[model samples]
Target: MLEAARTTPTALWNDSSDLSELKQSIAFGGVGATCNPVIAYSTIKKHLDVWRPRIEAIAAANPTWGESQIGWQAVRDMSVEAAALLKPIFDEHNGRNGRLSVQTDPRFHRDAKALADQAVEFHGLADNIVVKIPATKVGIEAIEDATYRGVSINVTVSFSVPQAVQAGEAIERGLVRREAEGHDVSRMGPVVTLMVGRIDDWLKHVVARDKLFVDPSALEWAGVAAIKRAYEVFQARGLRSRVLSAAFRNVLQWSELIGGDLVVSPPFKWQEIINASGYDVVEKINEPVHEHYLEELNRIPDFRKLYEVDGMTIEEFEDFGPTRKTLRQFLEADADLDALVRDILIPAP
Candidate 1:
């Protein structure tokens, strides 16, 4: 476990940030941490006793702002605090690790400049901040612009080989543009996340809804297969951006991608469970997904769209089944955050 945490260039990450957690998980071998708007909302709700007063102060100080503005201010403050705790480690890693990823508003998904502009602002909040832009078409454009402006990016809302590859290519283009202008790209560490579990979840939903006869176990490997193929594509093309595995469901979410230069981030709850399990971490990244499981899983058209390199086009990404599902869920999280702030700003009678 120590070897898995320290030796491998694969950055072990905890998807949540807290004071003790920042120390504990990093000491347990995490070099990076990530937060989406959903996690940010959850963090505020988790510590209402501590943040409620400050939130009230924010509302008072920003009388011109709505719930969305007040809520996002909370996220900004939380992210900066987490980044402070990780700064030393970030310095130690020379920018490869010790990053706190703050996501842009999901509501801005259709607007490239809104996403990129927010990303640049968040990137200014902390030196170690890696901003997450969704993998939608506009997001890809936003990501490239943000990167050219020197924002280290973490691509989110991605679930397939095509999305990962496209995002990676976008980052590469941005890097090259920066280099052309004599900018330093050395300290920038950008990663494209392949949310393995979410893809698996969507496939499972499809299997049950359609009453398809896929082998039960085949569903488990759907995400693993997509990531494995994506990793291969990344390697074969020499893309500078790394592939990150997120949304852990089973141990394979963390276990199977052990050795590759991958970022395996489980949420804080599962991080404790995984750290306690004492599972032997070995090099399994290069190992191919079982051919039988692949064959069974490919029975689903969605799986093929995810598993194949040409599965979806840039134009088609926003409408893809899993993409739509995740975007809806993330947007709902923003709405929930707004409602949370609204209740405090204007107490319900």
Candidate 2:
């Protein structure tokens, strides 16, 4: 699989905070992991026995910290532990793989300075950590500022070619700035995370509601098509930032993007399916966007504008279909975590 004609893709675990699961994933060929608010909340709830002592220690030290701060601290500790486990892989790959992502509070997604500050703090947790920043209008600026400050970043919530292109350009701009300041550009790491599955899910609902007809075959391939288009744009731009294909929903999405210079963070179920298939040969399935589907999608002006362009103004990128929805989801997750911490956990402060 590694010696095939196409690029050998790296596998990254999609969840964080389970040591046993993390070890299992690593043994099953995963080199990294991603941490999000929902995962963090789940970890806290399920592993209370494991995290209780640490949470108590944090509360004891802070004395007056609120639920939000304490919740994030727990998240930081779990992410750091995950990063420690992946550090050797990171070292071996020269900082390209073995990344453990720690996401910032989504409430701060619109604040560039706060996001940058949170990223810097997360970077301080471990050397193998990549701070996950939302691909919002201010997020691009935050990515640029964080990269310029020598921080590795994973620009999350990207759903279109324009968002991915803007993210890559932001990282490039930051690297250039860092180089001007005498920092080594080779050490900086940035990944633009293009979400699959969700695009198709959204389009499915839209088609169902509006009763606009399109080829069902083309609808099934919408997610993969979006990813392929994003990959093409990334290649044409010649940017240094890597592309991380995330939010996969099925086996076909996994098999189709087999050989690419991208990181795939498929959920545990999909990973199991791939492992059971015993697939050893790598095949390149980079098909062009389906014409009929593209035409159908173009009926929605926003979808067409974003799909056709490689780049867009920051305003357009923020208002793009999945970006807004994904950010709200993250914020809701953060809020849910806060509620859980306040209502259930009684850390002595």
lDDT of each: 0.89, 0.76
TM-score of each: 0.98, 0.91
Candidate 1 accuracy as TM-score: 0.98
- RMSD, every candidate, angstroms: 1.1, 2.9
Which residue pairs clash within candidate 2? none
Residue-by-residue lDDT tens digits, candidate 1, 1-349 = 4468776666788888765676788878888898887777888898899888988999899899999999999888888998998899889989988899999999999999999999999999999999999998999999999999999999999999999999999999999999999999999989999999999999999999999999999899999999989999999999998899998888888778888887988887777887788777788888998999999999999999988999899999999888898898889999999999988878989
| Clash tally, candidates in order | 0, 0
The runs of at least 3 residues in candidate 2 whose Cα sits more than 4 Å from the true structure, single-residue gaps closed, are: 1-17, 289-302, 310-312, 346-349
Candidate 1 wrong stretches, greater than 4 Å? none
- Lowest-lDDT window of 10 residues in candidate 2? 1-10
Candidate 1 least-lDDT 10 residues: 1-10
